[model samples]
Target: MFDITVLGCSGGTLEVGTSAYLVKSSRVAYQEILERELTDEIVAVDCGSGLAKLCEIVYDELCGEGDSMATKSLSFYTKDQVSCLEKFTSRGIKRVGMQLDTQCESTPMQVAWKLNHMVKNYLLTHPHLDHCSGLVINSPSFGAHSGKRVHGLDSTCKALGENVFNNVIWPDLTASDKGSCLQLCSMEDHVPKAINSTYTVTPFKVKHGELTSSESYASTSFVISHRVLKRSILMFGDLEADDPDTPNEGLNWKIWQHVAPMIVDGSLRTVMIECSTPNVDANQPLYGHLTPATLFQELLRLRDMVRSLNGSETLEGLEVLITHIKHENAMIPDPREVILGELTELKTLHNLEVNFTILLPGQTYTVS
Candidate 1:
């Protein structure tokens, strides 16, 4: 079974945190369960802001030190005061900064520095700050000695290079203090990129169309498969299918067509998708995000595609674990309920045994 930890699974809102998931494919032996060591190779899908909260939770669980970092946020640091913060930092946490922006901040560079021993491979779905800002700060903080790799689409990489890492808003972590700890790698759509001997990651374009010329963003979903475990997890970064009312369109259908083949082959075991709002009315549909209703529609399309690929095979044991639900708003009803309720309705309508799970922050799930 592959284990996935919900680091920070909120939507675009910083107050609610953002996306950052840790996946581990390795399993401990039955006899060694008690003494199981943490996985050496940790794959991060998206490390956005609000990740400091997850860091704090993990810190409390592991070190029991709740007094030092009572305040969350990593923006308190100003590039020049690394030495001062390191004084109070834990062992191996080479540096520290003042508190960051609590709503849209990541775990301090020191925290990441302390855990830099683990091989981290970050995969970016897009260049949105809520999706990749944390990675930008933390990955390169290990300085000249670090070796973190970030994978993204060509356009996504270009966006990061021009906007985030061009020594403008932030220093290019890929080239700071001699060399960068983070190495940016560009990925091609629909091509299987091998992470190691056991794991492979395939990227597919999603329908997060551009908003403005400056904010020309594109999204790429991922399919992660482990050869040894024989399990695959499909992650939809952020999506919205073409609107019958708009002139812009064409990413979601193509992605569906590419993934439907895998579903028929039974290679895709679990789907970790995002549902941002309850319905289209509550969402800014032009921005390319999904609501519960849109997500349901997407699933219907998926069902039809899978059926077209392979006659009438029951999609039993398929897991649809949802992520990236927006935070509760005073203006609208709670989206979590609406999303789960919609999924329940779909299960009843289809009479399928597919499992639907809601990923909450700090929760751990095993998807096989």
Candidate 2:
């Protein structure tokens, strides 16, 4: 069975103990299973702290401890604050932030802090709150406001270890005593504490077509080699490319050909690619997103490329899991499944030999 667990595909955290989940490849040893693996540390790709509410906390401080404020949009703090206001936080929340948004199917607002805690390593696909909010280590607020940003919280840069939480967009969480203004984390902060694993995480910027070329959501790709469990799952936060000016115009295949082959170059056990829509849906997949049809075409193209390269590594029967379905085409009952069904049928017809799975909400698949 898969050690993975899906919290939500297109929305909210499943109620605790809900069993609407899947386990794909669970082959852990008796002792491994006896010892809980998931823990409380997280790897966040993005953090979107609401400003109006955050400022209100500072506003309350200026107004005086019990002083009431007119409006409190939302503060990025814990729930133990003053009267009439509740903090927006999860007990296990981490302060790891990045320069992106969150996943559409992202509900926990985190990628998961503790994946089998016995293994302390972590990986995040890109900068997005839905994927990273669960792991943010800290936020940077001015000390004048309260001796520290989100005052007195231990989520400062040093406390987080190797970061200067980017002051460009978010405040510098590092203390002035640390000698840095910015507070963003470096690559070192991502590796796990132990477990004798060869896991490595790397990010590469990818340009999507016009349809997906929005600013706040620029796409970045993630390649994680989870050496411990011998698992590797690659996914981009959220992605898209601009369809040409013409409605019928599609992604530039020539450019894609150049990059596609390289994507499989990395050695991995399993690769989770994001396929968000059906080809007829019109959005370009792979810029940071993938439509079922586009994904089909891309895979075929990739298979052919691999054959031509004369490489023995064939994904013909390789397990390929698809994630990040758009609200319209997702397996869920939204209005978009009409065309989605057609696209899924096409995939079935191809019977591409590769293990294809459309990840469901709360679903977990093994890594075999």
How many pairs collide in each candidate, listed in order? 4, 56
lDDT of each: 0.64, 0.37
TM-scores across all candidates? 0.76, 0.49
Residue-level lDDT of model 2, residues 19-122, one tens digit each, is: 11112124443123223442221222222222222233233333343223211211112245432221111122111111112222322212121121222223
Q: Which segments of model 2 are wrong by more than 4 Å?
A: 11-122, 136-184, 187-197, 208-217, 228-231, 241-269, 279-288, 311-314, 328-332, 335-340, 348-351
Give the 10-residue window scoring lowest on summed lDDT in candidate 1. 89-98
What would the TM-score be for candidate 1 when compared with the true structure? 0.76
lDDT for 367 in candidate 2 is 47
lDDT of 1 by residue, 1-368 (tens): 56666567777565435788777654642113212323334577887742464466445444544323322322222234322222222231111111223332334343433443354577889888878877766654456646667789998888888898888977877764657767788999989998655668989877675677555357888888777766777887887765545412456666667767877787776788887766656535436677666676667667777888888855666777777777646455445556777777867886766677766555556666
Cα distance off (Å), candidate 1, residue 14: 2.6
